[model samples]
Target: MDYRFSEQGGVTHVTLTGQLNFAANEDFQAIVERIAKIRGGKVVFDLATLTHIDSVGLGLLYIAHEELAAVGSSLSLLHPRDTVLRMLQLTEASETFDIIS
Candidate 1:
């Protein structure tokens, strides 16, 4: 996966593209770690271009969420595709995560 990070309205936005699987491990973790290090910013994950995701990807997402929460920041995952969306829903994580189109 490829991600671009930007800032807007006091929120940090990350746009992720490509497949969110094991191949994306390193970069994904780097991005999440970078975001986690930043304090007091609302982190918005724009997953509109992500076509697929796996359990490892979800685990990274959970880590990101936990990191952000621990740092007193907030994280939001947005624009998930049907499969990824379903996975989140099936896991009941959609209730805790703010998913938007």
Candidate 2:
């Protein structure tokens, strides 16, 4: 997957596109690590353009959440595609994150 990072209203916004799968694991982790370094406020992942996600991608998301929380920040998943949304629901991920549309 490819992502664009920006800052607005003191919040970090990450817009992800393409497939978020194992192929992107290394890049995804690197990006998340960088994002985790931010001091505080919200980190929003805009998933509207994301087409697919696999188990590894989902795990990375959870890791990103925990890492950000540990730094006194937060992670929010936004505009997830219908299929991805279903995956999140099926996995009961809503309880672990704040998802916004």
Candidate 3:
């Protein structure tokens, strides 16, 4: 997976592309670290280009959520593709995250 980070209106936006899996672990960790620095900040993950996600990818999202929550930050997921959305739903992660269309 590949990602780009940007800031808009005081919110951090991350655009994810390609596939999300174990291969993305290292890169995702960097994102988590960046998020750890923010206090009471808002983050949005744009998953429109993310075509696929596996269990490991789901776990990474959870880790990010936990990390951000611990630091008084919030995470939101935006425009997840159908397949990715299905996985999130199957795992009940849809309920855990704030997903925006």
Q: Write the per-residue lDDT of candidate 2 for residues 10-30, one digit (tens) a residue.
A: 999999999988998998998
lDDT of 3 by residue, 1-101 (tens): 89999999999999999998999999999988987798899999999999999999999999999999999999999999999999988998867899886
RMSD of each: 1.2, 0.8, 0.7
lDDT of 1: 0.87
Q: Give lDDT tens digits, candidate 1, residues 16-68.
A: 99888889989988997898888877999998888888888888888888889
Weakest 10 consecutive residues, lDDT, candidate 1? 92-101
Model 3 quality (TM-score): 0.96
Model 2, runs deviating above 4 Å = none
The regions of model 1 sitting more than 4 angstroms off are none
**Candidate 2 overall lDDT versus native:** 0.91
The lDDT for every candidate, in the order shown, is 0.87, 0.91, 0.93
Candidate 1 clashing pairs, residues 3+ apart or interchain: none
